[model samples]
Target: MTGLDPELADATGKMLTQAVAEVVGDDPPVEVEESVVLGNAAEVLLERSCGAELLVVGSRGHGGFSGALLGSVGQHCVQHARCPVVVVRGSVS
Candidate 1:
């Protein structure tokens, strides 16, 4: 996962775990590696896409609506990911 701020990465990971549990019932054991990429969203997505089975990301990030309006990382992944990409959007409830 790529986050401009390190603090946000922890929150993002928690949110992702919860969201995944909601859909998948129980969370599976999987290896998650976090990295810091200092670049644009497109660049980040490109770096991870190579040789990846699937690139998963949140639909809306820390920027919320502003990020949505500006085309989120999810959007960039959808367009550029070499393999299949899953974008998870949080629900109101």
Candidate 2:
């Protein structure tokens, strides 16, 4: 998974991990790394997808814009990711 913003990455990772645990009934090992792309989620996915089996990213991001469409990073990854990508949507419940 690509996480460009540290704060967003942390929060999302925690939520994802929790959801997985709830569904699977076990806490698996999950590593949330901070990519070097900083503010660019596309660049981070491009770099991380070299040998990755799947690319997972949020549909929206930590930007000021909020609408019904996907964010810039989500759009770019959908078009450019080497492998299959999963774009998770909705806010944490």
Candidate 3:
């Protein structure tokens, strides 16, 4: 998540980048780049994804009914991203 708060955005970017790197591990590290923007998250992501091979986002489920499938930003990205968009939804056991 990016925008409004500089500290929050920086922390978020760092957290996400670190998480991705850890998930991929050092055996075959993945190439990752992060940008923090001060606008609509989905719009910024979509704009950035134009030159990307794929776009990945987590399902926040922030809108609609309580059990809604996707969040507003995720839904928008899936519909509009130029490249392939992957929405990862967390599962609770």
Q: What is the lDDT of every predicted structure here? A: 0.67, 0.67, 0.77
Q: Candidate 2 deviates by what RMSD?
A: 7.1
Which portions of model 2 show Cα errors greater than 4 Å? 1-26, 29-39, 61-68
Locate the minimum summed-lDDT window of 10 residues in model 2: 31-40
TM-score of each: 0.53, 0.52, 0.69
Candidate 1, number of clashes: 0
Candidate 2: TM-score? 0.52
Estimate, for each residue in 1-93, the C-alpha lDDT of model 1 and write its tens digit. 443576777766678677567666654566454454557767777788898877777665445464563355667778878989877656656
Error of 2 at 1 (Å): 17
Better of 2 and 3 by TM-score: 3
Q: Which stretches of candidate 3 lie over 4 Å from their true place?
A: 1-10, 27-29, 61-67, 91-93
**Residue-level lDDT tens digits of model 2 in 15-47:** 866766664465446643433344555787876
Query: Predictions ranked by TM-score, top down?
Result: 3, 1, 2
